[model samples]
Target: MLDALIQQSVCLTQHYTGSPVCNPSRAALLTGRYSHRTGSLDTLEWWGLERLALREEWLLPLGGLAVPGDLDHEAAKEDKEREARSDVHEPSRPSRFVSFAPLRDFVFQPAALDHYAATALFLACVRRLRPDFAPTADDARHIARICRLLEGMPLGIELAAPWAGKLPLGEIADELAAGLGLLATTLRDVPPRHRSMRAAFDRSWALLSVPERDILRQLSVFRGGFTREAAEAVAGATMADLSNLTDRSRLRVEPSGRYAVHELIRQYCGERLGAEHEAEAGETAEQVHDRHAAHYAGFLRVLEPQINWRASINSEVGPETGNLDAAWRWVIEQGRYELVQAMVMGLYHIAVAEGRYQTTLRLFDAAVQRLRAQRGRGEGGAGDAPTDLLLALLLFCQGHMCIDLGLLRRAEACTEESLAVLDGIAPGRLREEQTLYTKGLVALLRSWQGEFAEALRLRGELLSWLRTTEVSVWPHVPQVGTLFVQANECASLGFLTWHLGQYDVAQGWLRESLAIREQLGEERWRAYGLRTLAGVLRTIGELEDAERLTRKGLALSEAHQDRIGIGWSHSALAATLMSAGRPGEAQSHFVESLAVAQDSGHHALLILSLNGLGALALRRGNLDEAGQLYEESRASFERLGIAGTLRYAEAVIGLGEVALARGDWSRARARFREALAARACRAWEKMDAVAGMAQVFAGEGDTSQAAELLALVAHHPFTAHATRERVEALLAELEAELPAEVFAVATARGRARELDEAVECLAA
Candidate 1:
């Protein structure tokens, strides 16, 4: 019939299935709005047919219904309960008058419903039909689950709404998972087509040709959706087959031009694929599986660079993550170590960078489990250089993700294991370049763990190796030269040295790295180098230059949509602004940074921004606000198991500053000591904590100890900044209180003492 219409010069337009069942779909078609709006949400009841039930053949344009919001909030709970019961109490209300709630009523939008408007519509209609329903919090959640299980089909909602009265929402949802057999209706007046969800799908399925059926079955392997290119590769589906399936309402074309099938239809196709095909029992299945896996693997590998470096990485690659997972599972089953390694490496770091930490960890765990299993089976045993290399690289990637998640102990374990594996390989047998890469990662881990001297030593060694390593090809980033690796090493070395108070040397190394990245056209890494150098400049009191570099880095990251880059650059720029005494502007950038951090779930970036906000709050004398911010940051760091890091120390010390302001001498001293004891405490943070402790001593009438501690930090650059005015005033007051000779002696001894010696004195 569709072919006949096309032959007769008919134009077929795209539309939603309206509702999953016939009666509701017809009512929507007749009313030009949603089933709920027309008071025809049930499959068996003929909606709008009290006026007309003609079967004339004229052109019918079925406009799609807008989806409803996911009602999971407290207000939404009240509104949904009220709305659900409205139909039972107010049957005389207009079709649209049953207290329908808008999206704003929900506590928050569920992430899954962000795209599926049709699903939201079905959920609204289902909620409306159950006017007498009351539910617990868990039952309220089942609304989303039911919509998802039914794939937002109207017929499924119609069938499930009745069950809401006798059984719990969860039970109805669970029954739907058992298949369409549970969704049958007993209404005698309804058309046979609308009697069951399966009946509607069966009519369409029977109209398909053998090729169409095969393509549809194969396409069911895709989880979310698939592009034309993916379809052709994985399912051996041609454009014509897709068009036919689409025309027959067996498949859907999303606004992004990707194709999708309803979950119910996909399940049906899956069953057919399992039952009807001989390939499932033989070698042909392997070929099809290989093609499907290879298609997604290649897709990820091609986009790996963008995924790793861009802020828009999630939007670009998120749609295909389901397909990627499917590919990984297939390769794992086949014990294909090489493919598994490629798949994990391609997405793991990018996933972490985008804040999908749990997902990336799962990927790492699954791949590692497979690798260990292969080793136990002797497939990955000794002298298999390829498998060994794959395992080592996989472990390295896993460690990198662990670092981002603040799993410092887990990170070290994985990275050390990677190093151990690399060391076991004969020196000349393994690739020299990959070995250097692992060593570089270990250096980074050391830096994050606050072993500054060791970090600098390892990073310097990496720089030396990077200078001599030759590369004919730079994977993924072809335009980046061998100096790219050296440039990155130099940046790390500069940051490490800067933290250790070697400013001049840090400047030289940072400048050289930035110059190299710019010359090589390494845009993303160039942004990183700029932000790193900007931080160094900020530390050295070169505020103008620091602001300029940070601004450039921000612009570059904004252009590339690199969230990590944007976040880091924003932090650098904010700190620079704060140092320049522009607290208002700095607060704005910190707010932006916090928003981005929360959105991306980037723990490290979030901590930095929160600390910055706390610092700003302290300066403004909003002691309570500063305390709250610092406490939140400390809690997050502790939760992520990264409380020993320098960032967490800053938060701890900020809390001490608040305590000092509130005149809580004992509490201030304790908090300052806690900050000082953190292994990750860097020089500036240590100085800040010491200053806060000195203030506590002054408050306690221990002027001698207070003057000595104040003298230790008096010559530091922090004392010159506006942020330290309070500490500086306290020092002046203490200086006057002490005898001239005592003041001079204390200052002289402090100036002569090394940082470690001062720490020891404070501890005493």
Candidate 2:
């Protein structure tokens, strides 16, 4: 009878509402096959209807629904068959399938309304419900939050839109935190299940098989999303179960191959999981939580070795950050110290690499305090290698993160405590290696605090000791007898030598360090080496190579999202650009570096960017802005307790240049003298200072003295290219204003003076 009716009719249309099993039956009738075979196993129209195997002869267009690509191909094949049966071949019409879904768009796109078409649907519903409503800025913000909280479900937005007339937008948003109870409608024309979100969820829940329901409940343990492996391990879910849930619109599979439950659905399922239920597997919420924690803990432990060696493994960890965070919190709450120890180092490295400084710091700080409290209770004594080693490692990781964040005092305290903890361990290879690494970190702290000479001495001693020692440390790579600790010391010495203006020595050490790091295949540390080497190249007037190396380092850093590397690379690139006489480009990079440094709380990088910007401002004749920037850089350096460093001296020279630009001869001279007096001042910085003094002398009408000092700076091989260019230009101007014979005599005298003699003469 149904076939006779379909054969007799011109066209047939079927519509159903609020029936849990309607779509599957409709799909079965259309395809003449089992609904499961057609992949149509549920009644949710948006996700399930697309699974139907509708024939090509049917001209009905399903708006806002995307037919799968294979279905389109099937339709084309049927069209060719129909054409072959006819007398004349006809051109195939375009596929009538559209890929737009108003509700699904809201579900899949980012939470921002302006970026998604959901904003239109939301506004249309709002205007229909409350015609006089004009949203203020605050109302718009609340509306966006509402859209996000609802996951852009059309019914939820429609049900909540009517409340716009009865309550403030903020109140409506706040009420949503209470859950699905807040979104219900009284419209009599609507189906009962559609009248409230909970009713709809309940109807869907009743249709799920017991296994499906159990997996759904267990999946609530995840925060963001989970991969198939993660789902299997944590929730005991199979592929078929996940597919069925997805067909029912209970979960969303992202393009990254991760499955996500909607927040509202997750909350509902979480509540169900928490309640009493006789699940066949007999797993409770606590048991599921335990499994979730254990799975991620093991996951992190597997990645710990790679993380310890600073490999480019952040891509593997980034997607699972939410799950790892949830697992960490659970383990800490349950006082699962072994689990905590298993995952802590990996988490710390991942957090630092991703620039989640404050959150990781807070988490680790709490963990440390808890461990200390446990030790105080005599739960773990000094001879307990595992517990003591974990604590010491935690303190060291904390100290390293503190260095990045510019919390110097805290970093010092943590490093010292880490050493103390290691002292309690029995003498062994692990203890010895750990002690050497901790001491290396202490050298780094000292370097940052402007104690470069001491840092150099300490780092050199470590390198010497590692070279003589025959202990086999577990290398990051396959190479036997390669000491990464020795390579690290070499890099430290390179940095210290650079700070002390030993460019030739710095380059040699940095090259050696880079060679070892390249052999290890550590991309993060290799990028560091590249940027540090680029700094030396830029200082020695190799602007092109400097720019090339810096850009390469920047790309590597961006690939891993390493904030410190990104910040430093930008600053280095900007300085190189500035030296190449590209102030405009340099300013943009400096600004970018400053913003990243500020966001990452990298005080040293921030100061470097500020000083670079100051140099650019001075070059552009913006004296007041230059002065302000220099003063800010100086103040920040002082605050970091490294006021005597070469960077601080650079800032002082910048101030003197600003003063010289303003023709404030006395002030410029005083600032230059102050910079020259810095113990950490490099030869190039001293040259810059003396050049400023020449300008001051020229401004004070001492042309002969100015000519001599300018010639001294110009002839100094240690003078930077940009500084030499500026000094030469000044010399030309001065020679034009002086007697020819007198200018020649003064320049000859200046060229004969040694660098130290020239600096002493300028200072006098």
* lDDT by candidate, in order shown: 0.65, 0.71
Off by over 4 Å in 1: 1-31, 34-142, 145-151, 160-196, 279-286, 303-316, 427-431, 471-481, 580-588, 595-601, 619-622, 640-642, 717-746
| lDDT digits (tens) for residues 449-472 of candidate 2 | 667889999999889988898766
Error of 2 at 278 (Å): 7.5
Off by over 4 Å in 2: 1-150, 154-200, 277-280, 307-312, 470-482, 558-564, 584-588, 591-595, 622-646, 664-683, 702-718, 735-764
* Total backbone collisions for each predicted model: 9, 0
Candidate 1 TM-score, true structure as reference = 0.80
